[model samples]
Target: MEAQVFQALLVFVYTDTWPEVEQEDEPAMSQHLLVAADRYGLERLKLMCEDKLISHIDSNSVATLVSLAHTSSVPK
Candidate 1:
């Protein structure tokens, strides 16, 4: 993915809305999510939620990503 797309995805995943996701205007939040999901290996889940709203990023796949994101501090 392009750097801009990656950055946009990060913003989308962390923010609550498209407008709140970033100060600069860009493509739709869904596009960012799709790119991010592909770059981050969450394509399957991202596609599942493609037609949904950006606020639905907390679904199963995202939950898994959230868990994985915190796994570094988890005891093995």
Candidate 2:
């Protein structure tokens, strides 16, 4: 369940389909980072996204996250 949620959030973050409006339930891309951070225990990834990563992470970040979740050295 967590992984699924994480994937969904990742897609939301790394896609142009993201909505412009900021709402409580509808978080900004940064919020997805926070979710990933919490679920995967990726503090650095979260901070990087919060600080300098998200802006640079292209649309492919979602696919990267999916791939990472499937097979990567990173512990999740």
Candidate 3:
């Protein structure tokens, strides 16, 4: 499987949420999880990813994250 898919499965198998996983500043990993969650219509999973993303928010990257959120159709 592709890396993104593998990462999503890892999120499910390893932790209750993506933030709980120890990826450590891996925004790409989190992004993958968010996309997978959205694609699968897993609202809980998507929210978990969104919450995690919010937790990591910093001024410098906030715009990028917001852009990602918009592009991904993440909820407010």
Candidate 4:
């Protein structure tokens, strides 16, 4: 996990909220957070990340998002 990703996870763990991340960083942050949340059994966080990511779907990001979905099995 990246430092920012871990830091956001820690923030969420403690405060039930994520730190302020820039708009451009939200997708990647949510992706990493989704994976971390699953690995740690943080179901609500995982679902929130999934929802955030879904809203970010776009032509430029779709392929990567599909790959993440396949690899992480997040929707299932």
Q: Kindly give the stretch of ten consecutive residues in candidate 3 with the minimal lDDT sum.
A: 16-25
Number of the top-ranking candidate, with lDDT as the measure: 4
Q: Runs in model 2 with CA error above 4 Å?
A: 1-27, 52-76
Per-residue CA lDDT of candidate 4, range 3-75, in tens? 8888999999998976678998999899889889988989889888988988998999889888877877576
TM-score of each: 0.31, 0.30, 0.66, 0.88
> Which residue pairs in model 1 clash with each other?
none
Local accuracy of candidate 1 as per-residue lDDT tens digits, 5-35: 6665655567633324442332245445554
Error of 3 at 11 (Å): 5.1
lDDT of 4 at 66: 82
Native-structure RMSD, model 3? 3.2
lDDT of 4: 0.86
Point out the higher-scoring one by lDDT: 1 or 4: 4
Return the lDDT, model 2, position 44: 59
lDDT of 2 at 70: 57
Candidate 2 deviates by what RMSD? 11.8
Query: Which prediction has more favorable TM-score, 1 or 4?
Result: 4
